[model samples]
Target: MSGAVMDEIVMDGLRIDGCTVAFGGLRAIDNVTLDIPGGTITALIGPNGSGKSTFVNMVSGQIPPVAGRVVLKGQPITGLRPDRIVHRGLARTYQVPKVPKELTIQEVISVPLLYARSDRPLPSGVRSAADLAHYCGLRPAVTTRCGQLSVSDLRRLEIARALACRPEVLLLDESMAGLSLEDTDQVIGLVREIHVLGVTVVVIEHVMRIIARLCQHAIVLNQGRLLAEGAPQRVLTDPDVREAYLGKGFTL
Candidate 1:
């Protein structure tokens, strides 16, 4: 439970206050509020179309919330452009790999590195890119065309690309979906390694194995509202969470 508490950061904090998004009369996300502490991994889980992706989209600046505020490090970042958000220390990956078909894996990762390059003299951005790919276990596909990579390999490449941005916080959506057990384990390790580097991570996933293994804290949403938030084990066992996800057959 102590691990669920929000931690202070040099930048304000990642905060969502009373955020809601509506499509027509239906609320896709209803009045949800969440805080992701710096340097920790937070898991957001729910049944399909339960607003997990919409909420993350709002936070990542891909879509603006109809009502609510998103603040990062004490500054109001709501409605900011995606590129601006990245520059402000937020990076995001998608449920589907969005890599350019024409680009080599190296070229794909290099684009973000080049864009995020700082004036600070250290290893070249390319070297950092190499390290990111190697660290994420995508080294074998470094020279492969994005179109040539398998779904699991592309998933790894997407994560590597996000890391290349040098973001302080990352939003990973369904990163382990459609992966084999071995691939899932690899992703779990990559995610763990990323958090160890002091980068805050908010993961949206349907894989219970991942939620149980990688997240110290979890948030559950249903019908656009927050149903639960707490330690992963406790949250998973909650009556409300089970009802929302598993219905009557849910047990343990």
Candidate 2:
């Protein structure tokens, strides 16, 4: 290589540039590249084993891509560590919510805030741990132990904990995985409310109704590549998208 330098492009939000991740001979994510606009709720949907989780991991810096890079606002952030990523205004939730069995709901919210960068932007209702609990619909069981709360409440706690990080970009990974219909609707509304509070949100969800309700933009991934992306309604109804991923039954 010569002594050549590349200039950075001013991007509006998180940019994924030709990111690739492979395991042994299998490519979990194939040279995937896209941008997530700030201050909007975008839905990421795909069938089983379609690389949705892997993509979220790459963006959150949980696992670095073997190739390409991730940039945030013209900065080459792929080199930064995960905590640094969080401090730079990026945070994510997991598919399954877990907490110390001994920790109460209030304590669980406090732990992340204690470690978070003080300069990060605190989301709505984060002034006090109890305030966040109430915001997340955990007011009735504010002192409940993690192991004691119902599964749906546990899921709600995950979002509240992530918010304590005061992130500008929040990635939610299957946060509604095991919720009932009514609970799912409630969670969906909560997500929208969070977005309205000025946080850019990306949701990794399989629930079509939830996506249909919350997102105007949708990115569909199949076999670890960019399959289709655009308005959720149009992309979800594309012939190739329906045939290869959604099946014939799925339609607007």
TM-score per prediction, in order, is: 0.90, 0.90
C-alpha lDDT of all candidate models, in order: 0.82, 0.82
Among all windows of 10 consecutive residues in model 2, the one with the lowest summed lDDT is 1-10
Error of 1 at 227 (Å): 0.7
User: Mind sharing the TM-score for model 2?
Assistant: 0.90
Tens-digit lDDT track of model 2 for 136-161: 77755778888888888888898899
Instruction: Tell me how many residue pairs clash in candidate 2.
Output: 0
* lDDT digits (tens) for residues 37-105 of candidate 1: 666688999999899888878888888888999988778888888888887888889889877888888
What candidate 2 gets wrong by more than 4 Å, as runs, is 1-10, 246-252
